[model samples]
Target: MTDSLKKINKQIRFLSVYAMVSSVLLLIALFLILKKDRITGNLTVEELTANRINIVEPNGLPRLVLSNVEKSPANLNHGKPFGIPGGNRGGLIFYDDEATECGGLVFSGRKDSSGKYFASGHFSFDQYNQNQVLYLQYLDDNGDRKTGLYVDDWHNSPPYPEFRRTYKETEKLPNGPERDAKLKQLLEPVNGDPAFAHRVFIGKDANKASLINLSDKKGKPRIQLIVDSTGEAKINFLDSAGKVVYSLPNKANH
Candidate 1:
């Protein structure tokens, strides 16, 4: 080839290589800019405030909720318009991946019409569409107090939907004998023969006695071991009627 042709060809080859390199570099820079915009490394904030905050999963399912009194969200157990007077109580609520309320910590205190003070703090875990299966609670009513831990059993049939429906219906009824009777009938399955009942209670009772109570599935306390305020210890076995069947160390002895 002639020197001039060779030189021309060499120049074209160099320019071609340079163009390819420039295109790759530009593409890489564009990719980095897009990545930077899409990512967040860390953030710091001075203060954040809101009535309620929900932490959710990528699919928008709520996993946790931190809320003030007025904004507390109701759970599956309570459904909507929580029948209780303290639905506005402040608390941190937790939900399962399915967004079912599993448990939470709650607290409230108020005075009744009779000027009697009442307060309670509870941290509980539900039995999947059922009432609280386990809980730690502190309750004070007009200076009478009881702090305890409880584990309860629920009937398997009828399920949560029926329970929630009955609860809402009962709430609409007027406060009278009729309502009371309806409540009793509706609750008969749960309260009367409860498939399983209060299984365990470990706490201090209103009389300032420290006790551990174990009950039968029929809701009858079968055994109670107690230490009274004066430090007297007694263990009692009771029948279904709650009448003491027998006592250890005899009631007369400390």
Candidate 2:
């Protein structure tokens, strides 16, 4: 070949090499930018849309999750689902240091085919390894609405997951004496401590009564201070049997 032709071929090869090297460098730069965006922050966006988003700890444990109904997660115990899988409503779930579910906020509203409507919102916090100890909830079942804040006691012996497992197993049994007996046994107190008990309720009931109800450890209502819809107010003290043993403004006082 002539010298001029050889020089032309050399120029073409050099251009080809340069283009390939430039493409590789561009890719490396893009990858670094993406990694930095995820790990170190400083990236900004105007908007983002997604079905579910999970924010995790450095070790990959989930710290928080925001999700839609179809992609919602179930109750998590130490990072594993424990209760009815997929039973949890769409909402935000908060995890504790141990990766256990510590609290949550959930809400839902819908109308049935029969034209009945229902809505509910709940915010609750759980005791370590147990169920909710405090909560505020609102429920509307076909327009019968009740909103309340409640405090409760739960057993610490059986971890919540174990208790739920046994309860689910008991529910599988046929409706009979055996099933009833199992339910009673499972629900009864453990070594004199109640398995679960509602200790206080402060809210408006379906009857439109604003009230404060205090219960004993066994969950028996011991006292109630109420103001009915008509604005009539009274205080009632009850016996363990749940019968009101005393009331303010009795016949003698009135």
Candidate 3:
């Protein structure tokens, strides 16, 4: 090849290489800036409401906790990633940890003049039930949202089977010899103890689970299968009148 032609080809090669490098550098810079911006306002109210609470970066990866005081008690999972239960996406679950299950009164949602669903906490307390609700925000096919309770003739959608379950360990305690020992530990009835016994609800779920109903004999149990839990549990198996029917680990009367 002629020297002139060779020189021209080398210059063209340099220019092409320079263009590719420039394009790559520009993309990297863009990504970094977006990353910074993404972190600034990452925690949305939708997350807290749906109980699908989580933190994400621009790329949708989980957020790291700088310290405990800054973290909501709900976010602490003892090393598991923010594994909110709506699968990889997320979900909305309404609940009231302080309410009694007798009549299901506690609710969290925006209540408008017509008592339609808005964005607010309008909890009520029955004689024994407390009006309180927690919001869950999660990303689903419908995207991020805040779910709430259904009040007196209030308009609300049906429950999401995937987001909540109230009953604790629904299947029976497996009466056979295999599970007898462990079942005894979990089902120790509070026959006459002053301390109330309870099966706690702990998870991202919001649906009220099946109650732990005792058999005709006070201490005999009937396990109603339901989803996992969400960390707010009181110790009591309420009667039809919202009083304690059975408690775990029946205490000895002094």
Q: Which one is best on lDDT? A: 2
Tens digits of per-residue lDDT for model 3, 7-125: 99999999999999999999999999899887664545543323324444455444421212223222212223232332221122222232112121122234457655533222332
Model 1, residue 104: C-alpha shift (Å) = 0.6
lDDT minimum window of 10 residues, candidate 2: 185-194
lDDT of 1 at 137: 98
Best-first order by lDDT: 2, 1, 3
lDDT for model 2 comes to 0.90
Question: Model 1 scores what on Cα lDDT?
Answer: 0.82
Ten contiguous residues minimizing lDDT sum, candidate 3:
154-163
lDDT (C-alpha) at residue 6 in model 1:
95
Residues 1-254 of candidate 2: C-alpha lDDT, one tens digit per residue: 69999999999999999999999999999999999987888757799889899989999998888988888888788888885676458899889988999888999999999999999999999999998999999999997989999999998868989988998999999999999888887888465446899999999999999999999999899999999999999899999999989998686676
What's each prediction's TM-score? 0.72, 0.89, 0.27
**Model 1 misplaced regions, further than 4 Å:** 1-40, 77-87, 110-116, 168-185, 190-192, 251-254
Clashing pairs in 1: none
Better of 2 and 3 by lDDT: 2
After TM-score superposition, the amount by which residue 89's alpha carbon in candidate 3 deviates from its true location, in angstroms, is 17
How much lDDT does candidate 3 score? 0.35
Output the better candidate (2/3) by TM-score: 2
Q: Which ranges in model 3 have alpha carbons more than 4 Å from their true place?
A: 41-191, 197-254
